[model samples]
Target: MTVAPGPADHAELQRQLPGLGQAPGPVDAAVPAAHALLVHPRARQAIVLGGLNIGYELVRVRRRSIGMVVTAEGLSVRAPRWVGLGDIEAALQAKARWLLGKLGEQGERQRRLAAGRIDWVDGACLPYLGETLVLRLDPQQRGLALREAAAGDTPPGRRLLLGLPPQADAVQVRDAVQSWLMKEARRVFLERLAHYAPTLGVQVRRLALSSAQTRWGSASADGSIRLNWRLIHFSLATLDYVVVHELAHLRHMDHSPRFWDVVRDVLPDFDQARAALRDPVLPAFD
Candidate 1:
């Protein structure tokens, strides 16, 4: 998602995953309730949909319509304070298929991420600039350094030398590598900003590295941009698509046709890059 760094009125794009089907239809009482169970940690209400029992956390807010979000934890429903409990359940029932599909997809995504979690040990591997890099502990080194692949190396691939002893714990190694990645992200982002700003005819006021979980980048009306540091793991084309996407926001804050026109002007093949960005199973740092 791309957000505008300002008040609530500012526009932001919500990131949507593919294969999450369309909005569900109206509640069907005739549909037999299944016995499946999905419970949220702070759930206070339960609903039966498509024969499955789903426990979700309900939050009363100042919003007009009931909104549902499915995360790694499960479902959370937020509705207007004046909306009745029955109405809330009706909203959920109306969207039962979509909710259930999203919940299952979230669970599968979490499982894949856990399975791909990188172990911060010597010879542990992680993606860097769309390529795999193996970790190499070098206590005598000053800090993190990237070295070309050397023969006889265990992985025989690119190596990132960490200035830590062989006894260094996982926490130490993870922190050290993360620090290097952030610094490198800043450097690369700055260079790309310079490369694309002139083409888009915009001046970037500032750039910040963001650790946002859902957002890839955001651009404020003031020309400030924040890009997720994890993007450095992908190819440069994918990274540039995000950069141009935000820079174009400086010209047009909303994602109107004109805004995309500006982005398309700078990156003709941006659609491919955008699709490619979603295909990679990024290494789980945590």
Candidate 2:
């Protein structure tokens, strides 16, 4: 004889319960636990728990769209507005393993960088234009100057001399250096923008400094360009590359082959400069 399916068999219970021979009676006892199987239409390989469906989207373009955002408040899943909540949560849970792994890696990298000491005072070694620039404090010099030592230049040696009070604190020193660098950045950036504009057959209508957190530079379709002020920490060559990259955007906004072609036309080996731009140093502040 064949054994009949019980309440433990959820699928079988669901199938058989609806077809019981007796006429429908008033609800007697509550439905058994196994009878509850939630089916979400938008769910793809996602598990359903407590009536909530969770999943992940394979492709997303907007940066604001949340992939896996967890906070003390609760787990929140944001996707394109068109995506259903069930699908969003399901997608998140499906990629939970990968997302946790990436978060751990990022945390570790940040810890390493944080542990690395960054001296912001004079005599500290800092990266500038693909080379290291040693900071020198000279009370005699009246103002900031990028000094290139001559064949027999004296005691201070070859270095960028920053003139400040001997008793100035770190903030004062940092501020003074930044003020000078930004002044130079404005002048130099415009000069470079003008220098490369003609060759690329594009005109730069306006230039501005950007203090954006996530982007190095940006360009408007209307011939306006914005470069990160932090770029002052980089070498002149690297700075020029960024200028060219933004200027090129005047013609091609996307990083498509055509856009890169425009950039390459002006700075042939831009890849090196681009690579150098990724240095993980914070901007100095006074």
Cα RMSD to native, each candidate?
Answer: 10.9, 14.7
Please, what are the lDDT tens digits per residue for candidate 2 over residues 166-272? Answer: 56677777777777767877887888888989988899888898878778889999998988877877878889899888888888889999998888888888888
Best by lDDT: 1
Off by over 4 Å in 2: 1-108, 115-117, 149-158, 283-286
Looking at model 1, residue 215 earns an lDDT score of 85
Clashes (N, CA, C under 3 Å) per candidate? 2, 12
Candidate 1, residues 106-168, lDDT tens digits: the string is 767776677679888888888787788999998998888999997787776799999899889
Top candidate on TM-score is 1
Q: Model 1, 40: alpha-carbon shift in Å?
A: 9.8
- What is the Cα-based TM-score of model 2? 0.57
